[model samples]
Target: MPHLHGRVAAQESVFARMSRLAAQRGAVNLGQGFPGTAPPAFLLDAARGALGRFDQYAPPAGLPALRDALGADLGVDGADVTVTCGATEALHLLALALLGPGDEALMLEPVFDVYLPQVALAGATGVTVPLTLDAARGWQFNLGALAGAVTPRTRALLLNSPFNPTGTVFTEEELAGIVALARQHDLWIISDEVYDELYFGPRPTPLRILAPERTFTVGSAGKRLEATGWRVGWIAAPPGVTPGVLGLRQITSFSAPAPLQAAVAAALPVARDAGFYDGLRAGYAARMTRLASGLRDLGATVFEPRGTYFLTALHPHWTADSLLDAGVAVIPGEAFYARHAAPAGLTRWAFCKSDAEIELALTRLAARPELTDV
Candidate 1:
């Protein structure tokens, strides 16, 4: 066999590995962040309607209708949007387009697992800035540490909010500090806002809104619509950067699935008019409360998430392996961090599951005397 690229050979997604283990062990699989429910009927209907007509390859940039719809929803110009296969691909495209050898990208610690590897793929150094967990404020990054990480080689800053693992939605003050740093350093901002609509509090302010000239914002139709397999996402960049990202898109996936793009276009207006986002927040808030309470009952310290359907808990007696054996699957907190050691006993649980699945996971944990025994 031909020798594989080092990056490809070295990469093993912990999510895929754990999901497989959970299946083999018959564990209630909270290890992956995918929703267990079907997408809404309106979205399915739109997909069906488009399947016959929009099946051909879309323009490399994307279907104009979908781009317009996304623009309207995101408050950006249609020309600024380039739809991609998913947010993962969008991030990869941005990294490749904006970074190169000897360049550096700053990433906050416990990043979405893809950020560091994508930076590496671009032949860029990824510098980690640790985010400390604050009991009252949730996860916070120090401006001083972030400033120290920037140098002449720094080209970009990658951020995820309603952040994965911790689920900390960046507040206005935090975002302002980050935006200030980006301006001072003349760095591009790649903000992953896949969970933008899934927030529980006042809607998150997109970084593009704060610093449009310097930010490339990533969003996911699949995440918002609960259709992860659809693989529909977009990058809303400033006009200056749009052409470069679209050029990269032509070489990458070329274009996202045309029918899926049309379906998302058709569904976006309906979702907005029907108050779907409000219901989504309410449902996830209830689920977060249920799961957080359940974990607390099991003697774990649950950090309540303000946005995103994930919760992190600290428990001296439980680890990912132990929980998997107890028939409840989770990802160890350490899997999310690139350089810093995660707090001892911290584990991330996906609450994207249904109430029934969450209860079953709780029951499985409660039944294991070894997990609760201090």
Candidate 2:
């Protein structure tokens, strides 16, 4: 019998496990980051129209028009963009292209769950630098820790802005510090900006804009369009890096679905003109506010998010399992950390859910006030 890959067989993803538990318990699931809403009508219409015209494999790099649209959105040349199955695949391809045995990648903690695994799969080590969580300031980047983590063997810095689980959008100062380190160390920068358009405050500056020579920007049309099922994503690399990404992509998923790529291409311009992004930001802001307020009312300390649809909260007495038992599901903050335990009692909740769903989870939580006393 053949042995399975060790990491692949070790454990199911916490997100998948929690979502499954939520289903089994018939609870309002706030564990995963997927949006509860559908993509806007115009985007759906474009997908339908595209499906009628494009049914074959797209060019491994992407449909030319989609690449062009992505380039326009990211302020990069079209030839530098390579479409991928999702930002997940883009990250994996990057690991394969830029890292190997004896190399290290700097990962900011709470890291996205995929970063460490992908680095391991590429035979590279992930060096994690934990961010500080201030009650008033939210998550703060530790420039000193990042600098200390860099080694001669370090190959890349993997970054996520409008960061997941914590929803901390990296500030320009932090980004600049990171860029400076990348420059000083001669390391590659893989910027995961899938949630770029979902910011609540000022938009985050792309790292590529600060250090184009060594940065690769990864984006997700699915996240921006509120259609995670589409799985349309791309990497906007510097000209020299694009070809390697495209080559790895050819053997990975080959290309994202042609119609989906076409649909995203068609929708990007219309979404921009119709203020779809503004509406998305406004809607998610309301949801986050509602959830945060409810958690506060229940004696939980909520970290107000500046962007993204998730927030981390501290309820010393409540665990994620306890929340699930109370009819709502969430992810434990520890799931995001690679090297350190999450601050005691922190858990991540997703407000990407519909208003009613958010309210129901809050109501369920309110009914179990004793859970917080335990």
Best lDDT among the predictions, by candidate number? 1
lDDT digits (tens) for residues 1-374 of candidate 1: 88876666755799998999999989999989999778989999999999889989999889999999999999999999999999999999999999999999998888788888889999999999898986556676687899899999999999888788788888799899999999999999999999999888788889999999999999999889999989999999987678878778899989899999999999999999999988888888888899999888888888887778899988999889999989989999989887999988989999988999999999989998888876
lDDT by residue for model 2 (22-81), tens:
999999999998999888999989989998698998999999999899888788899999
- Model 1: lDDT of residue 106: 95
Overall lDDT per candidate, in order of appearance: 0.90, 0.89
Q: How accurate is candidate 2 locally (lDDT)?
A: 0.89
Q: Could you tell me how far off, in angstroms, the CA of residue 235 lies in candidate 2 after the best superposition? A: 0.2
- Clash counts per candidate, in order, are 0, 0
Model 1 stretches astray by more than 4 angstroms: 134-137
Q: Candidate 1's error at 257, in angstroms?
A: 1.0
